[model samples]
Target chain A: MFPGKYQAVHAAALTVVLLALAASGVQAFIFSDPGSLYTAAIPDSWIYQAYHSTDQLAVFYGEGDWDLLYFEGLGKVADQSVRELAERSLALYGEPGGLSGFQLETPLLPVEVGGLQGLACAYTYQDERGNLLWEYRIFLLLPDGEGFSIALGSNGPWVKNNPPVLEEVLKKWQWTD
Target chain B: MAVDRLRKLSAWVIVLLFFSVIAAPVQASAASSGKAGAARFERALGGGAVPEILKQYGGEYVLPLGQRLWVEEVFRRLVGAAERQDVEYTLTVLNSAELNAFALPGGYVFITRGLVNAIGRDEAKLAAVLGHEIAHIEEKHGMNAVLRQMGLTVLLEVGMLAVDFASADLLRLAGTTLLELISRGWGREAEFEADLVGQTLAVRAGFDGSGAVSLLDGVLNLDSEDLPMKVFRTHPDTQERRERLEANLASFWPPPAAVDDPQVLERLNGGRILAQAGRNDPRGRYIVSLQENGAGLHIFDLQLGESALWLEGASVRDFAWSPQGQYLAVTLDEVSGDAVWICDRWGHVKRQIDLGRRRASQLSWSPEGKQLALLISDSGSQGILVTYAEADALVPMAADLGVEYSTWLEDGLFIFTGDAWYCISPPPVVPVTVQNPVPQVLQRQRILSPTVIKEGSTIRLTRPSLTMP
Candidate 1:
């Protein structure tokens, strides 16, 4: 009787391990592309789409009013410091009264992405209909003199509701090249 | 036992149903929210006006019309004076302190307040700056530059797509090409051509053609450590350009006359304004002249000796000093017509070459100071006429509708034009029939800034030259 019990327990443990492996594989399949210049692990519930072209490569994920855009090879800036480039990147957002009232939520701070030094900041703005929106941005300088940027935006209330998910997404971002 | 198991399964099914009911609304709300966010983002990027976009990027400045009245007036006068009037021009004064001026498609010209203030009170210099931007518009140099950048075939294909579908990406590509042109600057040849056209337009509009030189001088005076300045980076070789301007001043316009009228002399002497001075004159005295309220040329010695009225009852457009500084070639704009006067150091008219009806331009004195080459134009027909101080006749050299610009070669053997250098052997005697000689092609490539320099017996040109047979 004890022998059979031991066998039963072993089989159950193997099944659980297999299920965990399948879940992780499904997540990787949905979120990551090894052939791309960069990849990120997105939440399973979000929709993912990739845009590829000679000039630009981008990945966009959306769920409800929360959206994230990861851009690689976004063109070049005149030889300038990465900090200045980050400031310029912030200017791409439409100003107040149209789509967003641009306000700095967090000052630019040093961060590391893909083992390369970069800058990260958070900003808040009002949408066209006066809804409070927030965005987190990361700017990285590539070795090839090109720049990479990431923008994660969502309604203020949604971001407040899902802090852990947002942090996980940010943590999972990786640069392949 | 079967009843107990069925009861447990029924309880589990109820729990699943309860969770689905709670989560369905949340998923639906998220989908709707995502759609809305996407729409908002697309609208934001796609619908903003260019001016607003430019503002967001700190690319423009808001200057009141009152503050820019003078600039606007000068710009309007230049636009009215230009030969091409197909497009109405709008001028904007950027708020930045950078010394830059540029033109956009649809006849929009932008000049920084720094450039304007730096130019200050010198209307003619302002005209030179504006005229350059206008020439870029008139010649469509910007478009040509973009075409060169994007390749003609590819640009044309994208242009078709832009027109047919109004595709934003194609339009954006075109816009990017234009921005690059502005940032990188037009080719050196294009820049030189614009300079020529600009000075011509300024002179035609009754502004001093030398203002271009002065403007460049001001640009060179700017702090170079400000490396972010677009003018310096985009415009290469400022020193070379200044040298070219000096050469052009000597080759094209007449030297400034020496003003001698008592009132004009008093004003100039009191203000210490030496309008024109010969470089390294042996006598240690300079020739100074001033226009008497835009009507007469009053030439005198800056040493305060005696004042003499050089030419009365006529407006002087330009004047130039001979290489030896003995004679002054004065171009007068008269009520009757334009005339070139050769005056001595004493402000006496030694000889007069009346260019009847045909406007006289680009008076160049030969190295020996014996022959003066005059470019004469009438009703769009242009020809070169060589004049001698000893003789009253004009020797016709080369006349063609295609002659855009001409300069006297150092040896006095040829006149260099944009396409070819025409060999003009002076007539053996005065009052001889005009001889047309075949032009020797010095440069097979298109010459942009064809500057002819005479170093001893060697003739050096700005562009590459072929062996002259």
Candidate 2:
């Protein structure tokens, strides 16, 4: 009868601690968030309306993160033609996301999209804002017309200060005609 | 304390050993998967397709040796002769000793110097060869071979991998073994069909179909000892067929009238025959231009546009662009003796490769730009396609196409259109194992038209209408 009091007390404490741990684990599992982004295409045209809040980019001809060939084919020429368009476009408008007053470097990778026809490009250009913006750009020539697209996102300490919401929303903007 | 430490270490070792045993099989499976993937890739690229590969060896550059100007003139004449038939062509003379000829993917025809020399100045024999090569193209033999090759490669790789041979080395070994097994899959029927088609074409183009018989006779006599083996290995039985051809002189339509023109004969003979060729030196990718006269040619480029230059006129025609763009020498042609010029994309002279007296005719460059092929031709014996470098001439690429008037599509690939037989190269030496088999063959579409524009990046040619009865 004297030993029974200590055993009962130990069992009660163990049960309380176990319940707390299980509850905490369940809460974490239910509320933790994962990161992802994607786009949906509409009918009758090759335009895509993105549906995410993070910086989004895509390649139509070549692969890798920094490809501009998908945008170039919108201009109508296929294959290495995208590279030429990208180079020429960069020369006309400077860099798409850097502060070097539009200084865009040519693509370093061999990624292409839409068969073996288009190449990709990645660059940095300065936006209207004096602040430097890093942008992912693409060059493509579609059956309809030539096109160039830019995705501007904040980089460095600035990105942590202001999230890429504007750039994320703009990813949906594309030429339909 | 020491004993306790020793026990702990032993326990750790046991755990490590257990993991190794458990993971080894999985790692092996992963390695096998990589190999399987590689094999599939190789097959897709047609890298291990031996007959196709052999047919392509040293076939990318134009031979810049011999009387290049005269050869060009001969080609121009052939173009004129083809005007009536409304067929456009691309020609290349290969530098090799084997008496062979072939048509390639797209409209490409190659002839070897050996065939040229053996046939001598016989215009009829040359016409026969041209007709046969053109017939192969008309029947789409090259395309068939390519399609079959690609399909076989995929099936073979997938089938082998399914059988658990998943190692990369296994895939490679399987590919090699399969290549040897699949060499020269074209059989007798295709050869006969090509022969018939060639004969018909000769008659349509105003040449005597008897030329076919004469050309065959020349080929038989030139390599009489090996004719049976060659015919048996690559074609169906020919004795009865030859007899039929010999006896049925009435069946072969005659040239409606006795209109004789040496220039027409020369054009047909010089341009169409002995034009099997290719390039060396890790030859770059080829861009082909098919003209109305049923004549076509492949030009190698560096960065495209005006910057591109034609690597023509070396007696050996041995240098070509590699993937990284290197050059090598392979064969020697007799016409390479004259001054040869490398033309820019605009056909302007860029550089010269000279061979004093020995004329070069057949030329090819490797796709990787690491090797070159040259064929030497003369009045003596037909020349051979030799592999070489700037100074060192290596072994012959193969003996199927000759070097006279030729062009290359890429390294290891060419069109040998010569002397009544349009043949692919590296000689797909079939062994005596398979039963009556339908060997794969190459075929292409023949466009008969006249080119009118030569400016810009495109050419417009008037399509010719065929009045088939």
Report the number of the highest-TM-score candidate: 1
Per-residue lDDT tens digits for candidate 2, residues B100-125, read 66654334566665565555544445
Docking class of 1: incorrect
lDDT of residue B289 for candidate 2: 32
Task: Give TM-score, chain B, model 2.
Answer: 0.33
Off by over 4 Å in 1: A1-177, B1-67, B153-169, B221-223, B226-228, B246-469
Docking quality band of candidate 2, CAPRI definitions:
incorrect
DockQ of 1: 0.00
Query: What is the C-alpha local distance difference test score of candidate 2?
Result: 0.40
Report how far off residue B371 is in candidate 1 (Å): 21
lDDT of 1 by residue, B1-469 (tens): 9999999887656545533543344343444334333233222222333374356335666442223445666787678767755555778777678777877654667788778877776776888899988887777676567545544434244542112112344345556666656667777877787777877776666665567776776667767776446766767587776666545543443322233356643443353322332223334454445475655556444565655565676577767666676766777776678898887755568787777787887666766565677777878877777665433435554565344444443424344345434444432211111121111101011222456887322366653222111
Of candidate 1 chain B, the 10-residue stretch with the lowest lDDT total is B434-443
Q: Which stretches of candidate 2 lie over 4 Å from their true place?
A: A1-177, B1-88, B145-185, B222-233, B247-249, B252-469
lDDT of 1 by residue, A123-158 (tens): 776543565666666777777766666556665534
